[model samples]
Target: MGVKKTVFKTFKFILKNRLLFFLILLILLGALSYYYSENYYLHEEDPSSENFLLNYPDGHVVSLEGWVVDVYPGGFKLYIYHHGKDTIFDVRSNTNVSVGDNVFVKGNLDDEKIITAKKVVLKQYWMYIFLLARSALAILIVIILLLRYWKFHLENWEIVRRK
Candidate 1:
């Protein structure tokens, strides 16, 4: 059979078993929500709070304490102190922080090999769009799965009468 026909056949089978399909879907979505919520809650941690520091290992923890220096077109840079040493860290261009605002950043030190920010506390607007898109996709998948189940039941009844 062609690829399209094979896919249709599989979909038909899934639709015919609506209860099973829905149950599996519920489990999948629940797991996804749980995972995403964990990551989302982590974003709420306060960098300036002493309570936050207790969670991270000493050497791995980096604390940047300074006022926002320059808000360039690309990104904002902060001048901070590290054990009497001064250093500059750049927040990506799209961050919502303004110049001259005091802030603290708590993050791990990525070795100088290739710098990558695992988690950035500063406001980034595009994250909302990404989250919305994910929600839309999950909704669409559930709707399609339900429609397939209905189609399978209708087709199955038709086949029985023909026989």
Candidate 2:
């Protein structure tokens, strides 16, 4: 009798505040969508062009990630020594990259083997930091909402399931 009463009370509390439930669901969905878009749906322009490769056999579209050696309004130059070639990429863009910062670039190479950057990814490390912060925020919100409306609080190892 006591278990039945407890279950009934819990169900009543949750069902009475459908709006809160919806809000929690929406926030969880938002966090999930954010992860999805970053991981799966992100699209970047292909730097490889047949014209560039054909016209200049020495240079073509390449993806390079290296330390920024110099910066200018029009573009920045990078130095990659990983392949032991000590290759220099003179990318064309006024990106936020500064000297010594590691960056990823996708661009076409000119006759001189300089890459004219089509896209630049800066501070790749920050992406992971932002993801963690965003997920933590979403979880915190769900916990708060659950405590307020459902009269339920989660511990470190609690699991939630819905009927």
Candidate 3:
């Protein structure tokens, strides 16, 4: 009987403070998400980690996408930034690429950490900016439409359909 009364009281408290309960739930989920993301790239056994890749023998084929840091006569230096284990891949390719350009390279990693690229694909920076602009416009339109159809009732702390 005592356990039943305590359980009932706890349930009543949760119902009375439903907003606080949900806020705490959301925060807990967010914290867990952050923790998982931060550790995901740093795992020792993960193939993407620098330590894991360093153990691989020479002539291993790999695919990488990163920004071109430098452009020289025969090839360019590709800067792959991943979770502070940043690496600059010395890529030897015939593909015409400029500094600050995003490129995807399928290549072989030599013993000296150089990459002999078999294929190089250039990703234009302008296209990315255009995509972001379009997304922002679409999001703005959606927000406007939502506001037109819904009204927030401060008295009840709820969103009600506009009549």
RMSD list, candidates in order: 13.8, 12.5, 4.7
- Best lDDT goes to which candidate? 3
For model 1, the local distance difference test gives 0.56
lDDT of 2 by residue, 59-160 (tens): 555666777888888888887764244566678887887787778887766645577777788864466468789999999999887766553226734345
Q: Is candidate 2 or candidate 3 better by lDDT?
A: 3
Clashing pairs in 2: 75-93
TM-score of each model, in listed order: 0.29, 0.40, 0.62
For model 2, how big is the CA root-mean-square deviation? 12.5
Model 1 misplaced stretches (Cα beyond 4 Å)? 1-63, 107-163
Report the error of model 1 at residue 156, Å.
Answer: 99
Stretches of candidate 3 exceeding 4 Å from the true structure: 1-57
Scanning candidate 3 in windows of ten residues, the lowest lDDT window is: 44-53
Evaluated at residue 128, the lDDT of candidate 2 is 49
Better of 1 and 2 by TM-score: 2
Name the lDDT value of residue 67 in candidate 3.
91
* Backbone clash count, each prediction separately: 3, 1, 0
